[model samples]
Target: MNETLPMTGKMNIAANDDWWRGAVIYQIYPRSFRDTNGDGIGDLRGIVKGLDYIADLGVDGIWISPFFTSPMKDFGYDVADYCGIDPSFGTFEDFDAIIAKAHDLGLKVIIDQVYSHTSDEHAWFHESRQDRTNPKADWYVWADPKPDGSPPSNWQSVFGGSAWQWDGPRRQYYLHNFLASQPDLNVHNREVQDALLDVARFWLDRGVDGFRLDALNFSMHDPQLRDNPPSGVPMERVTRPFDMQDKVYNQSHADIPAFLERIRATIDGYSGRFTVAEVGGPDPLAEMKAFTEDGKRLDSAYNFDFLYAPELTANRVRSSLSNWDGTPGEGWPSWAFSNHDAPRAITRWAQDGDVDRMARLSMLLLLSLRGNPIIYQGEELGLPQGHVAFEDLQDPEAIANWPHTLGRDGARTPMPWEANAPQAGFSNANRTWLKLDEAHKERAIDRQRSDPGSMVSYTRELLALRNSLPALVDGASRLLDTPEEIVAFVRTSDQGDVLCAFNLGEQAIDWAPPEEFASARMVADQDTVNGGNAIRDRIEARSGYWAK
Candidate 1:
């Protein structure tokens, strides 16, 4: 690996018309992002108020999670209407204002499109479940019961229990990959696919720049309703019963790609529009590649490769990057260490006292990668996971699984904007929907925006550095040989070659620079060594550097 060779064949993503390639996208979970009203729920206007703050971060775009009409059972993920905005989130006029403000700030707005399922309260689902002969009767996944009156298959819901739910009027079972209220759409039906495509058209026409397709792989299922095979893997900790099976028939369906082609065609009609699918399962890389394989599919896709990893290591980074090799016709990959669905990265990966240092290093590491990097809101502040008491928990997963899973509520806690203001300036209300992470007040945006050495300020510098360098933006990355404590790689392009190195361990270790990197100029970095194996050459704990 030390042979000093040109790494993977270089593929310039920007050469294509896709602007999302190698961009840094800030993910804003609508409810937790900011709340402008005293009603305690975040609305579109709240996001509008924060646009300038987001733009100043130097990111290329913003991906706002679901804000559509919903029952709030699964939060906004359970969509009641595709074209309408939920009242709690604001009106369509409020959405228009958000679109206008985001564009004025030169930030592309990517809204969530939850095409996999719809809330039971949705008009379509409501009509479809009524006596089975309605105009939209086949709009959802409805199946007949077996001779024994059991569910059609052994499929399981992601939340727990059988995937099939009995509908009283239809007298048949409807498949739901999540909560029973969230009935999976029958993408096999041409009308359903067309309707979803129209939903995409509705947003595109509304001036939204892009979409973050939620659970895109789960949009379709096997029409046969075959049972998923058992993985036979021993369960050390059964967080959910869904983990028992391989999830073959219920998701990652064969027909999903053809439907994606249709979605892509609709998006292609609108110039400069982008689409990224969020795919997750036991094996997501293959599906991620398939979804974005060609220019005709989604612009990019991201899986839980890093989001759900138990640990962060050099080998893991190298392996994940290798999968996306940046070869011609290969789809672009996106990476996220934390999001609304998972626990905070610092709490998950860093040692107790090393969060601040690890946060800086993680920012550098993420920005230096080969593809687009998604920064979860408050990540710049280095917010650790909040401790949510059992009685205070609103997340169904946390409540059901209890201590087994970390649950998503911790990451979805309200973002702290001010250190002393009520609810950390998230709202003027006496109470917010979810409690603000009190520990995050110390790392609030107001506090870090002023301190030059703060994590938030360092994030700005890192982004600025990344934007200024083509090697960091769209270059081909090749892993370098390093000791177990270090994760090192080289990004090469016509602009130049850059060596990126990180110390993952918690000790200040002596490491000698390779001959070619010895006199390399410092481009962008954090807590790196100074000279050679001498005392000055020791890289501090949880630090990294980029040199060219």
Candidate 2:
């Protein structure tokens, strides 16, 4: 296990029953990744074209955002057809090609499964809405309006407004935790659960290595439709009525674990299938633990611990990682500093004029964590959030709450492939779904691919180091006592011990290296270390070091 894995060439991935444990997964937002067919939208073929790029990043797998048949209301989250491919993203042949290419490149492909909700255009929803007594009427969460014709309960949608939508034909209100066009599924129904499981089988049969369950906790809701109680503590940045409520009844239902068991069973029938749920709510940690507990559900789960954090601090890292301290039978955790739904880490965590250094430090921190690390598209390039004018906005949530919410559109911009090419080589079309950030050109893939000091190259080095070290991958991690401005942790395993330290602050700090780490050897570039005293004392601002 002391082999030094290079990031530039073909290599065999660990073919163990638990390859997902501590694996590095690269997340690809299809619409923003790379466009083919000159449609200004990334398609399955585009993913195939970039398979080499992803493989070169040294990640174990790739988690592609939804490309299923959808009306594009919530992008692909509001799936119109569970088993069909979206025409906008090319046909099924293109998908199969991408899967084959990824597998050939030794990269496992994990597609998003949005079973929590479906587009209003879905056939089942259409049939259910046609009449209350239809065969598919119970497929969605439907409730009768109150005597005064108001919503059945006080539940609110995550995107603002009421969670219940009025249907004229059925004369009833349907529950929708997200956009009105996206109706919550009736997972409580045995038939609906079976149907969704069948959908999983379809993809597994098609050779997808795993699934990234989108909002798994949001799949099941309280059958009572009770009004959510208000939070006692006032929210500091309330954007919608949804934020005011505790969100107890609308999400994180107790019945979710049972459904997860069924999903796990289905995936278990297939060889080497992995599942990771995206749990976001009032108590994401508790929900994530429950969803992945007992090894009978998902293999891993990630919460919004670092996704929406305003500042990156020592306490935040310690507190978040502490929740997943590897208890017996406890579920494994997956971590991400940036994703399609959140702002980029460079934009959110970097101090003024320190984006490049912060980017490298963040990669080292992510790879050194005691869980699977998911690198979002363009995160390797250290791309910042793109700026979009109010008039150019396409996201429903951002448009509904302008000037208040930072809007995920900024983070969902196109990936800059070629620094000088039109549209940054994302697509040949002049117009893209979201505006491309001007600053991204400087951090484009072509520009950084050859620069050894570039963020992309640094990411490759850090990932390679992580892959080479068994201690950093599957070892026990303990937070070390350090100043508030610095985060230090010791990872231990049978292989060896590794110490990772980072300065989150802007000013250099004097740090007395632990006796155990006095003779440690550096793993990558010690950009922030004071060469004057070795590891005896000193740390530069917005930099980190990994030593064994």
Candidate 3:
């Protein structure tokens, strides 16, 4: 008998199964995850070395933050060379090594591709700004300002200040929805679209499994140069002025889907490839559906569902879930608890509020949802945001929006591996690029990996339970009519049935579930406290439970 026969169970991902469906993606923020050269910053080799740890978590793929060649103003988000890696993170060859190692572990590699903008120093941008006659002048969004030297319109950058910047050479204000140095690409141009597609193909050919497109909704804009209307209501977020506008014309353009389809078609041509968009806005459901409707665009996407804002109350979760409604082919929801752009969920939602229970509840909630879930680095250990002072802040967006916003620096701290090592086991340097909180060492991965009651252990249990149940993995969710204090749902599939419920508050509440959940059995829950068959005649606040 042949040992390598079909029954041996090889991955077959390269030829079979659409890999993105119901996948679990782990997001790696390279700068602070692990430092290999003792340079006080994490690099590609360190990530490769840590691949085993991530793969052990059983994620379907890994979404690596940008490591492209560039100045580090916004870390690697601002790209100088699209096809090559920055020397700071390591060479292009080092990235290839990471890709190869990740594949060996059955962990697909997906990288963050920032296509909406590029660093000012990029050869393409530099040449495009030389003069209007340059081959690439039309390559970016360049327009003449009004006669009064005001911006082309009322558009504002996400970071700060006007979105338009004056260029001496071009004698026009070029649009940059981010920093002046990071100019927005002229995505409306066919040549620009083709060039960007070429960049995507470069990584796909190099064996990448997928891409998590950054600011995908910002890819195209209104061609008429119309002014964006100021938001009728004052922005609830006082930290940044950009949120004050309706952004109807400035972004979320109708033509963006056409460009996305082009990219999707190219991805479809490649075997075993996938694409997910990172969309952030107010009307996320409509936008998400528009992008993924009828398979014409993005494979899946996650929005600001719970990334921002305060505590995850029962009503908020219920409302957010209602937006999806688990309808057929409308759009699939990919959820995230934390990422580089937002505050760490543990600290943002729980931690000080009831760290242990919140950690367990969040883990269970994310897995039970009907979408591909993404877990951020250090989240498994229940690591809280680092305490960063003004001098230690490196993120431009955070710094630009000071006291009004806490800034993302605190959430982007180095990952803790060793409980008592220097630099929280992230680096051996006298000083790290960002401060490592001394308190987090106690919750380091090395310390928690063996503790059954630790958040990491709970995470493993929750993920394992979800994986074991077919109904929870890919199923249609029916929202159960429960109290505002409790959000319960049933996941039904051909294989079996499962129940998911969460008590979104801090106090206990009694509730009767719908008749459908009577046949379900407990699969997993907050380890320290059980919901008792999820019948819970009552449940505590910030509590969660799952039954099969």
Candidate 4:
């Protein structure tokens, strides 16, 4: 770790409360970002050391994944202590240093808040399972089993088994939407909600800027313990039984929005604080909107529309963007093509094709959209998915459904920083938590730091350009009529209108801009426009254009 980095006091940037709108947030999976100690795992000190690099990316903020005390059952997702930093990650002082360094660099810091469940090792869970009459007995979702000793409901765990785990002491079953070790909380209980709110106040009082609520829809469930219905589709080649069910009773309870309102009220006390929820399910759009509805809930919500997408198409982009039309009282949306849980977009979309071109085009499109765009760590470097063998896998979901799904381990590999340094400059230890991919070494930050054509450089340029244009920042967008392979949209604002177009196909075609944008000046492009004009008579394949 570089100990020389200064940890200055917080310095506020001149921005309004709505600064998060159209802002670019870069997500850092702390365990994979950089390792400071010889333990081969990244920590808070490592994040402090990398603040300058992150600030240089032109992103407005950084969202660090969960680093709270955990049992490592789900790689820090199963929180054992919501207020304490895990010793493996670092100390509370180390976390404060990160907040200081990030704010000093003009970057806001957002940490993950996992409130849906807690690790079975947590004191709350331990005490709740001891007896039914304890003070915290109803803290978690518990139900009596059927006379035949069956689970309370037919719900399935996201990690492959039943969502209920039997507690011998209580002589009843407990709900766990994810791994059995991660027992779901009874968020409907007022006492439980108050405790979670106290956890939020703990972080907010510590000078943290915001939170990315994890699995928020799973925070509340049906109190009746009703069974989930079939998905109404064939379950051919399903890896987990959870995919076969509609997940109605297990998650997305109607009362969740009221709890979200409580969360909003808590954060609203702290000025300039932001909150975005991570919602996923069969029908996530409605839940997402409910979670981020106008002034009562979260500030924004991001779904898995693009994160879990099998492929990227013009129609898919059009349909996804069309859902959030900026209507009155509608909630804002956040967009991400890659994250710690999903495979890199380049690997998923550019299979057997030119990855470099796809990376640039994807970056262009993400920044061109109306919603806030989140760039995952190493995404600016165009890092592809790393290959983790069966024996080396650490994800419980991946281990449970082995050989069938390319688990999230591939995308959680350490961030490569040097081309020739040991462990790709991620660590100096003999071995890291997850092996580094040799292919990533060539695309390391050291190699691309000075290369103008590198993905990192291109990403920085795009972010700067995006920041400079109000039409791209907080403008109203409208889709244009185009061919099947072409997607064109216009963003209108008080300053001006910016036209964005992209070719999702491999063949170049003769295309013309709408009559209004025919003479617009080209502000950014991937070799798609000619001589400052938005386009010539033709646009190249795998290219994008942004004009004002």
Candidate number achieving the greatest lDDT relative to the actual structure: 4
Off by over 4 Å in 4: 1-14, 527-534
RMSD of each: 5.1, 2.5, 3.3, 3.3
Candidate ranking under lDDT, highest first, comes to: 4, 2, 1, 3
Compared with the true structure, the alpha-carbon lDDT of candidate 1 equals 0.83
Task: Please give, for residues 1-548, the per-residue lDDT of candidate 4 as tens digits.
Answer: 12222212111122677778888899999999999997899999999888888887788899999999998889899999999899989999999999898877778889999989999999999999999999999999999999899999999998888999999999999999999999999999999999999999999999888999999989989998888998866767577888888888889889999999999999999999889999887579988877877768999999898898877889989998899999888988899999999888888898557778778888889988888899999889988888898988888878888888778999999999889999999999998999888889999998997887788877776776676678888889999988888999999998789999888877887888988877788888863322366356577777888987
Candidate 2 global CA lDDT score: 0.85
At residue 44, candidate 2 shows an lDDT of 85
**Displacement of the residue 179 alpha carbon in candidate 1, Å:** 0.4
Residue-by-residue lDDT tens digits, candidate 1, 1-548: 11221212112332244667777899999898889878877878889888888877778789999988899999999999989888998988899898888776667888999999999999999899887788899999999999999999999888889999998899999999999999999988999989999999999999988899999888888888889998766788566679889988889988888988999899989988888889998688889888987787888998898898877776778778878887788898889999999998878788656787678778888988898899999898899898788888999988998888889999999888899988888888887888887888898889888887788777776776676678878789887777888777888989888888877776877876667777786666664322222223567777778887
Stretches of candidate 1 above 4 Å error?
1-16, 506-514, 527-538
Q: By summed lDDT, which 10 consecutive residues of candidate 3 come out lowest?
A: 1-10
Output candidate 4 Cα RMSD. 3.3
TM-score, one value per model: 0.94, 0.96, 0.95, 0.96
Q: Relative to the true structure, how large is the alpha-carbon lDDT of every model?
A: 0.83, 0.85, 0.81, 0.87
Higher-ranked by lDDT: 3 or 4 = 4
Quantify how close model 1 is to the true structure by its C-alpha RMSD in Å.
5.1
- Candidate 4 overall lDDT versus native: 0.87
